[model samples]
Target: MTTLKTESPFIALSGVSKTYRTGNESLPIFTNLDMTIQGGDFVAVMGPSGSGKSTLLNLLAGIDHADTGDIQIAGQRLDHMGEAARAAWRAHHLGIVFQFYNLLPMLTAAENVELPLLLKPIPASVRRERVAKVLDLVGLGGRGKQNPTRMSGGQQQRVSIARAIVADPSLLLCDEPTGDLDRKSADDVLAMLGYLNRELGKTIVMVTHDPEAANAANRTLHLDKGVFVENEQVAA
Candidate 1:
């Protein structure tokens, strides 16, 4: 297991708040939340339904904006960045893995992994090289030609992970990445995430409900009523 390093935080949130509004009702998700995650640390966030777990991930990914306070990611202010700038920053600085594998059915695994690189001005040769490398890293080197519909749930999720990291993003945000997998497959995914954190030194924030999944991370934090309630350190 990797040691926890908090000398400098890679992600920080200060006094942040988020709310959803209906016709006449305002639903508050997070109120004055504060958190910090160190670089290269694997953190598991466990929470019940509607505890703002997903909302927290969205805020970190810059998919959703906060109503108040500051969100700093890799020394940049996500809370203050403009929409276009934030989208651009997110593309290069962070990668997200979803609960369901979000691969396009019509595209091959390699093609799907190449989507993020398409946003950059990288050369086609370099893009293909990156796509091939990440696929191989995720244990799907030869399966790159296969389509999503032809792969199993685990393989699909691995492909999704390949896509997320193909750009070599510094931070990885996973939202129930193994939620739809069997035990063995979930373990495989969790192990891969651990490798990414330990070997590659990529900072990871994963939200999961399974205690087994939480155990995979070095640090586990429980959230309830929009606030963190528990912080447990897992043994190596």
Candidate 2:
């Protein structure tokens, strides 16, 4: 397995906390949590409902900020970055896969994957080539012209994966990616994720409730009420 250099942290969180307030009620999800994820690491986060797994994922992705603590990714301090800067950073460095396959119905598979690259200044020819390469990598090369509605759930999710990785982001964040799929479809997606980690040396952090999904990762971390409670290393 490829490993990150010991001196650099791909993702780090220190003393992180999140709280919500409503009608004089205060809810504290987790407190004093610290984590460091290195490049090329495939880590899974698992917990029961309301355990703050989703919150942690959001914080790492820069969708939400912690009440107190620090977050740094790929040498950038996300906690201090402006919203626009964070968004730009995410666009260029992170690939996100949500639980639902959020494909644009009006766009074909290739077009959906090409959306990210559209933000860059690359020539049209180069962008198209990159799109085709990633689509082929995800095993959807010939299906590029098909509308997502015509595809199976598994195929649509593969297109979503293709879209996420089209920019060749170094970090891949998946939030319950297989939650809506059947066992076979889930397995297919997991296989693709594993392949991405092994073949592309991408750092992956997935939030999932399924033990089987967690098993696919190289390491598993348990989050409880916004705190990281356990870390387990899976055998290769």
lDDT values, one for every candidate: 0.90, 0.88
Q: Which ten residues in a row have the lowest lDDT in candidate 2?
A: 1-10
Off by over 4 Å in 2: 1-6
Instruction: Give lDDT tens digits, candidate 1, residues 1-236.
Output: 13334466889999999999999999999899999888888999999999999999999999899999899988889988889998899788788898898989989999999999999999999999888899999999888899888999999999999988888888999999999999999999999999999888889999999989889898887889799987666648
- Tell me how far the alpha carbon of residue 60 in candidate 2 is from the true structure, in angstroms, after superposition: 1.0
Candidate 2 on 57-94: residue-level lDDT in tens? 88888999889999988888999999999899988888
The candidate maximizing lDDT is: 1
Candidate 1 wrong stretches, greater than 4 Å = 1-6
Clashes of each: 0, 0
TM-score of 2: 0.95
For each of the candidates, the C-alpha root-mean-square deviation to the true structure, in angstroms, is 2.4, 1.9
